[model samples]
Target: MMMMLNNEESEIVKDEKSPCEKPIKLIELSEKPRVYRIPNFLSDEECTHLIESSKNKLRPCNEISSGVHRSGWGLFMKEGEEDHPITQNVFKKMKSFVNLTDSCEVMQVIRYNPGEETSSHFDYFNPLTTNGSMKIGLYGQRVCTILMYLCDVEEGGETSFPEVGVKVKPIKGDAVLFYNCKPNGDVDPLSLHQGDPVIKGTKWIAIKLINQKQQPSNNNNKEGSCAP
Candidate 1:
């Protein structure tokens, strides 16, 4: 079980235990639909590999708006047979930790240069009006989002969920996990979040958006199945 070390007004503190040997230090950013942070979720070697492999494939973050609101170089890695061991291991850890049979969407690698910023946005897409593909087995909706930090920032670049008063700084090898929808399957407004502007240094990160799994399970998996 995940150990809740303490509960503060704005955040919950704990050291989350995973299926893997490595223990994670968690900070609960929200309660409803759950938002938590996992320190040291990846190794330095893994972070370096992810950044190097996706560097050449980088492109502007938002194709439509371009560099107006959010400006950055980004790349994506989709699931396939041919994947690096580190990449595959990441998938395995996420899958096992979340207890989800449904696969993840294409992993996104994003880098924010100084002065670049992303406006606040909610992650869950409307089921009826959504245009993008959400299917990957039983996942018709985006349930969980797991973000990993590839590099540390020297100044700004903090992820904020304003409604919950949560702000997480980019820490190398750490991860932030949250749910887009509530237990009732409705999009939670509290899930609204934003990537604060990078002031002085560059920010490197990876995103794994997980869809709902189709398999039936008695496991009551909330965000991540880690016990603190």
Candidate 2:
């Protein structure tokens, strides 16, 4: 099911969905270079609830560093795994907004504290097997990323695509969706992004969407490696 926000009431405008219907006007950001703001994407109550849930479920900051070689907060979910009800609902809504399928997975939930930032990097285009080798023909291409900001930042901590000179601030209940790969399965250079260091209070949280269906193979193993 898909829902729209009235923008005025700041309430969730629910829309009944047919079995396989997709949401409308889920704009493609890669095709354009602008932030598509959906005001009140989550209601005030929903935002409060999510904050509480995150606080309750907060894992050690070191856990997130283990994955991205950066200091931050993170929680992971397998391709089809649905653990938390709140997270599941958020993921479903995101998928509906982009018309994503089961192949596109909710990879992680991440938060950045003051002074934390990820160096600019492009997502690897291939998936590594359990044995550390690249999947033969099953390399997963990252299509788009849905970064739903869960809290307001006091300063700094904007998601910056330096290559394109674009910066996105953290806004509660607002999502910044962008394409990381071209339709032809090429990684877009402009998608190289970094989390600017938070200068004041903690930057709170965001979601990283990984689309596995469009990933490429580690043919050369030249620049992009799947290892930590």
Candidate 3:
């Protein structure tokens, strides 16, 4: 059965005033899964800062599941690091682009070396899988994702939706936002995507995943919720 959005979930998409200093523009990439390309989402300095901070902290990324293949390195910020200036600044800009409430999951900086790529996958939880079910039981569903490109890839490294034939090239300081679930909270299969192999230069991206419910870590007297 498809779950419907409750008042709290509906509030997440309300058109609130942007918290940006500069004008914000959204370039539509796809409609079925509601994908958009945001240019200059991050400044050059912010991108450089994130890359620098993550350089010494990267570790091989974990696979989504036992058999799934995911290639890349990841640097996940510790809990309190959200107060760090670089991340705080990016989070502020992200709000201007998406009407997000409740604290977000920690940002993960990902690095893909030449020839590295993640096989196609869905960002939404697959309830049939044990890991997915466990995750959902704890954090609710991942309803949206905002990916920030920290550097340009000379040759490949495109975020591709094979089912839709949509490809977004990596451009420094740009961001791509996409919905993983419908307004009624059903997982959207059209949101399936992959990180194409980087052929020339490396690819660096920062990921922001928003869940349907607020996480326990951020439940400290915060007024808003992430739920339906």
Candidate 4:
């Protein structure tokens, strides 16, 4: 009877411990540029929560250089915004999913209405240009980027890589992860990408730029850069 009771207690303890949540599903979209798509990165409720929380914070995007053209509103989250419960949860999942270990820039949420889009641009800073070199010196090269789609659009708003002929539709809760640097730490030119115009409905997205090193003390660096 004593042995049977002990066995029953062990089974009860095992039943009480819940199973761990499953990781996000990753689909390889490219190899050379190291692009991937993560489906169900966020739940519908989580998507809505992020959209509602950041909608009012939107403003004109801060173009890193005059050569780049962007037609959209963006908001870079505050220093402690990551500590917010909603954003913190999302960040935790993203960090784990990508095996991200380096420091990251402040999160930026963007909104695009009909006819709005961003011209093709590279995520890494151009070492040749003065401004780009300065940014790189301060923040280091952007190693990777995680663009999370907060809502689905009715008509357009796909992220397109023209050279690779790859176009990813804006799907709520889906995320696109791409590497900006090669294995040898050199920036890749093939990382060029653009946000296609939204023809029908509005589009909402949140971008997290992962840097090669910890950001500097000054947090005034602008986002988005391109070659002339």
Best by TM-score: 3
Model 1, 1-228: lDDT tens digits are 454564563433333444555644566766875888877889888899889888887777766222135677776553442168888777766754564453345577788889886777766655655342433223446777788989999988888888888888999988999988888877787887788889988899888776665534322221211100
Give each prediction's root-mean-square deviation over alpha carbons: 6.5, 7.4, 7.6, 9.5
- List, residue by residue over 1-228, the lDDT tens digit for candidate 3: 112235421212323465566655566778887887778889998999899988888776653223345678776676676678877878887766555555455677889999988788887777888977877776778788888899999999999988789899999999888898988888899998889999999999988877777666654222111110
Can you give the lDDT of residue 102 in candidate 2?
A: 43
**Tens digits of per-residue lDDT for model 4, 1-228:** 011123311211111222215545556777778787777788787788777878897776645335668888877766666678878778777756444443567777888999988899888888899987987887778888899899989999999887788888989999888888887989988889999999999999988888777654465344553211
Q: Candidate 2: where is the Cα deviation over 4 Å? A: 1-37, 56-69, 78-84, 126-139, 214-228
What is the total number of backbone clashes in candidate 1?
A: 5
Off by more than 4 A, model 1: 7-19, 64-68, 78-82, 100-102, 128-139, 214-228
Tell me model 4's lDDT, rounded to 2 decimals.
0.74
TM-scores of the candidates are 0.79, 0.67, 0.83, 0.82
Residues forming the 10-long window of minimal summed lDDT in candidate 1: 219-228
Candidate 1 residue-wise lDDT at 105 = 51
Q: Using alpha carbons, what is the TM-score of model 3? A: 0.83
Write the number of the candidate with greater lDDT, choosing between 2 and 4: 4
lDDT score, candidate 1, position 12: 34
Better of 1 and 2 by lDDT: 1
* Clash totals in order: 5, 3, 0, 0
